[model samples]
Target: MCQDVIFHEIYSAGLLGEISLGLKRDTVEGLLGEPQDISVSSTPYILNYGSLQLSFSSNDPHATLQSIHLYFDEIVEFPHGLQLEGWLPNKSVSAEEFLIHAEHFNVVLEEDEQHTFKNPQIGFKSKADVIVVFTIEEESVKLYSIHLGKRPR
Candidate 1:
């Protein structure tokens, strides 16, 4: 089955997408249909929607959703194709522009040694969980592949 894309929207208030935090597995299925595969090993349960992946916490007895990661040429939005305070993803420019946009929204980001930028506060449903990462290259940033989830304890 052809699955519709889950646009990752960075809003001034929070994130909006096909798969986000605090959703039940069934709700996710209702949103994106049955996933191509599911992983429930020793690690957190994962629902793979092609390139996009939704990771749920093991502690969730009801299987509440915890995180969302998008890669493999996924599209992002600020929820329903709206811009976040006039900030939107621009594919025409370099990745630096993306960083600038994030800064414009006053998003607090922490850059790792590998040059990856993460704003844990941006895309999580649980207040205690945060782990969204943006991959930046030498000349541009790859918005197609982003990570949204809780930090592992």
Candidate 2:
């Protein structure tokens, strides 16, 4: 299948994950297995990745990814296509930077106690449904998380 490029920012500043945008549909499929689903409008196409939703404009390049929203995961934006080629000392800029570039709306990062990058037991009903439970060591910020239902509601 053919698709506009998509990106995701599910990792923290210190973690490792590659979520690029404006990727060719086949390229994205190659990187992310395949979109959980797909939708289309007159001038835009949507591809649903694991927890990432991408929107592309027909006015943009063939693989021009417009934006990405990782709904529940803390990080949910991307850097402009130019900055990556510079010396940023980052895997893909910082979470703070991605937010500004994404023009984030009324989203909030709960607490280190609310989300984690390690062994997070996430489940899905479709692709958007997520249940996250995490904890932070009061002084150190060591994080732990489990599936929402593994314990209870």
Candidate 3:
């Protein structure tokens, strides 16, 4: 149970609230408040804000926010433009179907070797901080557990 949990809408350019790649760690911490858990014993710091997990790169002195993972079961919303092909949480859809619809948005979700599909263009690809990831099981994708990340340059 997280106190002061807020529903930050995901924006079309792969932004979750004020969070994005290259954002300083403190800025993210300020926006989300104290994380329920912080794994600081690793190179890339991991902060858990309830069901939403954020990973930060340690290469920078400030530990910039690198990626964000949100659970479908978690209570969060996306702006109309950022919604994943209009697929909402708890909505059942097949992987193939999702891939087809994503194409219309210029987002191509290709299955990776890890049995997941990812679209690099989900965010501002030019900045390399935006990507959309999905996990599939039994041909159906879980609405929760979707990941969005920006690579640390």
Candidate 4:
């Protein structure tokens, strides 16, 4: 039950909860405890913690965190009292509800035109340096994943 997870965009780089871009992997592990699993096969290694996944630049334990992915099973709260409480694989969130939630933070989601007809996800620039992505199920438009990360240079 993680609550009060703030997403800060004022700095051009966003912050989610206590984690932010360029945070050391060790620091994140200290904040969130040990991850359930770690995947090192990719360039940006992934650390899985139930509904949350953190990506780091390398496999080193101290690698800098690059991105975060939050799945909708657990309770995810934000400023202005916005909360998402989807219940894993069984429950789903409607696009309308999600949009309203995003609006609370002044986040405008634009359809990813290039992938709309195929994968169907919406995203927006959180700031000059941050990108927010919301993965939506094609037919239902149900939110599948929410990703926050630094925009590539």
Candidate 5:
């Protein structure tokens, strides 16, 4: 059921098939059904859809989609055929494994300049200027979530 919701990367700028960046809030809901929850405390309101969360810009009258966050709790296919799945309750992808997959896809990742030994988060700007961020767990050195969004001005 989870795998049925595939988020395909389109031109490295937005998602395709299921949802895409710049889509209106209603469009996302129409595609994914109603969200499990909605978090409106932040500027970019988040619509929680199980393991996936779509953020929409609050500044726009139409509330256009701004970003996407996917948690690696269940098996999910990422760009370049990267399939990430968790074995434990807290599913995660090892940093080394991620690097290998990224290399396979020819996706170059730049380490966060503010990254430290204790906390590491690798990020890169895609050819379409979409910012890709991997949030890694400090203790396990595993990736917990992947975020895709436009580069902030």
Candidate 6:
């Protein structure tokens, strides 16, 4: 579990702004207006209505948001192709659904592009995969990302 979590209104809208900065929910609302949907779990509650999916942690501060900040998984290259192991979307949306919602997406080509994952983890991959990155646009926000390719095997 995350040790320190803070909630501010602006952090939500300001995530991509500074990346070096933090966001607050109120400021997000002020900029983006309102959330389209909200998903809550044991620890994090995600606010999704626009291009941004903001997740708020419900933990204490000695470990603020940065304390447990998760580093993005790197793309690893296999012998014949590249592998995609971990990628997070901030929601439970399926790869297919996500593909449809993406304004633009691209794949990182591999040699054979025929590598098979032994198992496809719920949100992460058990094996490597084709890299994908998508950009989605919303009223006051846009999601810029690098993602894993999820085309049919």
Q: Give a tens-digit lDDT track for model 6, residues 1-153.
A: 321111111111212322222344454445545556766562565545334344555322211122112212233211111111233343333345544433222221232223323232212221233233222223212112322222244
Best by TM-score: 4
lDDT of 3 by residue, 50-144 (tens): 56778887735478887777655545533232223334443354445545545544454444444333532121121222333444455455443
Clashes of 6: 19
TM-scores of the candidates in the order shown? 0.54, 0.34, 0.57, 0.68, 0.66, 0.30
Q: Model 6 residue 45 lDDT?
A: 51
Residue 72, candidate 3: Cα error in Å is 2.5
Off by over 4 Å in 4: 1-13, 40-42, 73-91, 119-125, 128-139
The CA root-mean-square deviation of candidate 4, after full C-alpha superposition on the true structure, stands at 6.1
lDDT of 4 by residue, 1-153 (tens): 432234323223365556777889888887777777888586879988876788999988788988877676436323221233322221266766755655655555655453344555665444433334445554665555666666667
Q: Which regions of candidate 6 fall more than 4 Å away from where they truly are? A: 1-21, 59-153
What is the lDDT of every predicted structure here?
0.49, 0.36, 0.53, 0.60, 0.58, 0.31
* Candidate 2 vs 6: which has more TM-score: 2
Query: Largest lDDT belongs to which candidate?
Result: 4
Clashes of each: 5, 5, 3, 0, 0, 19
Q: Show model 2 residue runs off by greater than 4 Å.
A: 1-16, 59-61, 73-153
Ranking by lDDT: 4, 5, 3, 1, 2, 6
CA lDDT, candidate 4, residue 123: 50
Evaluated against the true structure, the overall lDDT of model 2 is: 0.36
Tell me the spans in candidate 3 whose CA falls farther than 4 Å from its real position: 1-12, 59-61, 74-106, 113-139
